[model samples]
Target chain A: MTGRHPLVGALSAVALTFLLGPILLVVGVAFTAGDTIEFPPRGLSLRWFAQALSYGPFLEALRTSLLVAMAGTVLALALGLPVALALGRGGARSRGAIGTLFTLPVVVPELVLGYALFQILMVTFRVSAFGALLAGHTVLLLPYAVRVTGSSLAQADRSLEEAARGLGAGGWATFTRVTLPVIAPGVAAACVLSLVTSFNNVPLSLLLNGPGTTTLPVAMLHHVEFAFDPLVAAVCTLLLVLAVAVMLVTERLAGFTDVFARQEADRWRP
Target chain B: MWRRRTTGLLLAPGLAVLALVFLYPVAVTLVAAPAGVDDGGLADRLGALAADEHIWRAAARTVRVAALVTALCLLLGLPVGFLISRSPPRRRAVLLALAVFPLLLSTVVRTYSWLVILGRTGLLSRALTGLGLTERPTQLLYTETAVVIGLTQLFTPLVIITAYGAFAHVHPDLEAAARGLGASAGSAFRRVALPLALPGVLVGATLVFAGAVTAFTTPLLLGGTRTPTLATLLYDYANVTVDWSSAAAVALVMTVVVLAAGALAARVPAKAAPS
Candidate 1:
């Protein structure tokens, strides 16, 4: 088949070329000296990077994004860890319903969900505290935690917990002493992804942010709506790099199998 | 047993949060959409929604795009899925890694990537001009085509992975069995192999279909203000119009549509699927 059907080889190369070309093009434009968004950028300069770094809103938004993402990831973990444990302990009917609830953050359109949360916060509770916004992000963020943690727990070796309990560990102690360490990798992967998701989320952040709480993504969204700037490219480039890097690290850690598995990659050919 | 209470207790927070963030907002919208401007019956908002041709148009546009996107995902994804699965195991792993990398890349980055390449002054424009296909850079951005391109690129990998998984799981023994009985390679793949992989194909279609409809960022960024999908339409009401009640109505509509598609997808039989 190798020689008789050279089309396979040609096809693979063409697909790779298609997928890789745009990514490289964006990276190339970031280095271009042009003021407007031009690709095959005429000249190479780092001016945009300098400007992106110095721009006040861009800087502030970066800071806010990092803080919120960190806070969101941690809060998601704190809130969702228990839920994952509960899933392990719960009845079948309840677990399914509970899962539907938890993964709402993933499936729901961010705008509607965030707007709903915004309304509840402002109109119903009158709680416009940044803390409440943080809570909203956390609530949304937790579903990933529940998903990742629940999956890791589901795939975990029950024999390990049984072995620990047989050694006289209490249920709580067994989870802490045996279960947590084994599942820590999944938790870590989830946290990293959680941070990225919340960090890059624009719609929810737009609805939720107050005077000083705008994240980088929301800031970029606003900046684009008003006018274009090269700094947007610089910011986008940095975020893209960061995202690609996160993915590389995560894939390395998790072996691309888990993420692929969840997405149902196993059905493909040999 | 500690398990019963603990499981119930553990499930409580996630479920409660869902009620708060998900179900309640939906409930608020349902209860309040009809109750607009105080003490009114279902006449005001319901009448507007029922009468509005724009709503129907937007919905039809959304469904049309979603169907197209899923179709593209299936068409582009299946062969790619088969190709990736056939790679030498080591390179296969690497290719799979490259494939899923986009899934991890934030929707923002992916959208921006397309914007850079597909924009008027972008590389794609330059490339097209260089090839003498156009006198100047063609208008590729802010069109329904661009939206499809972005979404197809985004969701295609999931389809590939799903389809690939099914293909991979297809027991070599079965194919071998067919071939041993004098079936050609093509016939073996078509008759014996493809039928067993129907579950994966069904799963892939379901995922891509659901994913395409619910997707927001790519369409918003790529399609801009011109082509509005249901998610985008709902966003417009919620944010631009500042009408949560109407937005909720729209969101509920989207939820029901997506859920129906999902249910329809689920009913697709595995082994009896059309090749």
Candidate 2:
């Protein structure tokens, strides 16, 4: 690429500032001593943070979000890993159709997905709210796991597996020893991405959450409806910190931007 | 033969879960779209929805907002993606990371931040007043402008990332060659780089448009009662009115629009690597 002009660089910097401005403002407002959310925060204090921790619904929602994210990530990997393996090894002809099938949930709007799942779980089967949320999240997140793991499997060197097989190793043993080790980082990336996606989800959580089983984002939405206090800012700030930490870890382990690029690339690979 | 069987065996569990949880539910909802038909059958509900001015208004508003958001993302993303792709690898990584950072936060949190920034006493108003632009704080919140801004913030990163991938595949030398052949830098980019990057731009537009139209939290918080998009309309139908059929209808509309967009995007020729 030709070197970027100074004008483009400056403009990009301004755009970045615009994108990050509101999020940083939220974090700053969380420290306000004032009851209302204010800019410059009207004298800095951690009282709102304390209140966020003490708030029962917020705490319960936090716990529920963590549990659901963890469970959903695990389930996504279980489902996605196998599919990824199958698609990777099954070769060229059927890959496009099957991959699209597995990835259908990713492109489908969350509003639609949540609406459909709500009807099935609540109206049809009468499933528990928690179970429904977990199921919804797992399906929502499965595409990420499948795409990540499938790409890794496709990119894995065939020589090592061949070498293992040449040494008289059984298929399962060779896979467990060779293929698993190579794809473990991809799986880890998938797990982290799935957790983040699940935790940050709103429409699905909103539709599936019942009394006493609301996820954090859903609770925050309901909380915002009745009140617009600094307490909510405080809670949001904590979530922001957690998100930053996770992104940092994801960057260190697997380049965060590469995930998006890889996902796009995977879709077009015939 | 054995390997194929193993693949099937491995896929069976995931497929089972997907069918039960994802596919079946969506099929059920699609089938239930005609549930409220009285005497006119499916046509009756469709006619009723078509007659409902509120639904048409909401659908039109959703399409308008989504289109505007996609246009804005494309305008902003092109330069950012070019800059990122042209930068050194380390700087490129940092820029991409910063670009995607906003996406890491929850939609509620991001939308909530906008509530503070665009509220009457929020940052934008305070800044405007501080700068003496207005005598009183303006009501930026609860406006369609707020919804557009919020959605753009939420989704622009996606455009940049996808466009960067497209730009990366375009050989840098192609632009240089064009410039060498008497084309100005701007014209060189327009003639060479832009066409090659069109596919990624289309993909990004598809995603941003779909996301903006289907977005709930941002419109709910920022647009408030003033701007009711189809997503929120569906929410009201499902939750407030307990009208599953109406909600199903809205969901189906959204799905069709999104799928159509996706199909159009797919038709864009893939990135053309310079020979």
Candidate 3:
């Protein structure tokens, strides 16, 4: 590794501040005892946090967000696990093509994806609003599901699976008894990553939302449109804590920083 | 044969989901893009989209903002990446985690922070006025600059991570050798390591640019009514105007721009990948 270069280190400190300052500012603003949002609070209180929690719309939207995130993660994992197995273990010659196939959804903008889904689900297919939202979140989480789980599968001991097969086990039994346990951590990582991504999603959920079906992020967007109150900041602070928790869990499960970094680098590699 | 069958069987459900949920919908949009004009032939529908002036302006603004965000991210991300790459393993892990943690939060949350900082009564305004930089609180909100700043903040982490991976792959010893031969650290990084890392850096830039162009939330919230990007325009067409045809056309335009950006980046020589 290059020795610590003073200039690079200093510049990075400034850059990290720029990157993280606003988030800290929002967290501070959330604790304001004043009726309005402000950086330096008039007084310190958790009234806004109480308000956000008691707010019916936010609570409803939070429930919807959690339900969508949970269902989306499950659907993404169910469909994605097999693809990961095929890609990682099969050594399929068309790996690049399959990768591209799965990547198409991601490469397309979320705005476009959301609108397209809205059109197809609500307009063309006449699906329920919640069903469409769930479907949209699932598609959105598909890339993470395939990539994270697939990376785990790639690192799993292939010899273990072979050993199971050689012991007269069928493919199903070998997979269930051997491969599944080995890549279980990766699967868990993918699940949390997918859930968080789904939960935090905005554009897709925003567009796909209909009567009585608004996700938390979309609800926050609507709330902020008219109100610059601390309640929004309080809600945002609560979500921030949730995100940090998810990041820690993901780190313990799979070293998400490396997983995410490598995922993007490999994804966009020419 | 059995292996191939199993692989195909494994892939089928995922691909099927992709088709039904993603591919089919995208196809529907593209096909319906021409349907913006009723009772007209395909050419007339196409003509309407081609003649739409508002979309063209939004497209231009989207590209401009995206380019600005990409450039700013690259400037900020490279050093942070370098710092991360050169750190000890444990610290590197911690630094990388801090770098990307913002990504875990919703864009709604992140962009809200900017709304506080950039609004008339926000932090930036207060700071500028307090420092005698301005006579009064300045409204930076609802402008392209605000959109660029918001997006740059949002995407820099991605660029940092990608740049870290790229710089990590580059042999630091090569830079050291160049320095031994009388290259200053800056010159050494530029001549020895940067060329090696350009491919990865360019990939990061491309992704950032594409993300910025297609981004909805930041532009929608920060840029608002006074500024229009492709995503926001598409939203207006779809929701406000109820002009599905126009929305589809805008989506098509956005896709082409993003793909073109990707293709153009790919054409740039990676120069030298680290061995």
- What is the C-alpha interface RMSD of model 2? 2.6
Worst 10 residues of 1 chain B by lDDT: B33-42
| Fraction of native contacts (fnat) of each candidate | 0.36, 0.66, 0.66
lDDT-best of 2 and 3: 3
lDDT of 1 at B126: 83
The TM-score that candidate 1 achieves is 0.88
The segments of candidate 2 whose C-alpha lies over 4 angstroms from its true place after superposition are A91-93, A264-270, B33-45, B270-275
Looking at candidate 3 chain A, the ten consecutive residues that score lowest on lDDT are A261-270
RMSD to the true structure for each prediction, in A, is 3.7, 2.5, 2.1
True-vs-predicted CA distance for residue A136, candidate 3, Å = 1.4
Tens digits of per-residue lDDT for model 2, B1-275: 78778888888889898899989888767654423322233454476577678788888999999999999888777789888888888899888888877777888998898888899998889899999999999999998999999998888887888888888888899999998989877787788888888776777778888889889999999998778999998898878887765677777778888888877767655433332
Candidates 2 and 3 compared by TM-score, better number: 3
Estimate the lDDT of model 3. 0.85
C-alpha local distance difference test of each model: 0.71, 0.83, 0.85
Q: Clashes in model 2: which pairs?
A: none
Candidate 1 stretches with Cα past 4 Å from truth are: A1-5, A90-93, A129-132, A260-270, B30-45, B176-192, B269-275
TM-score of chain B for predicted candidate 2: 0.91
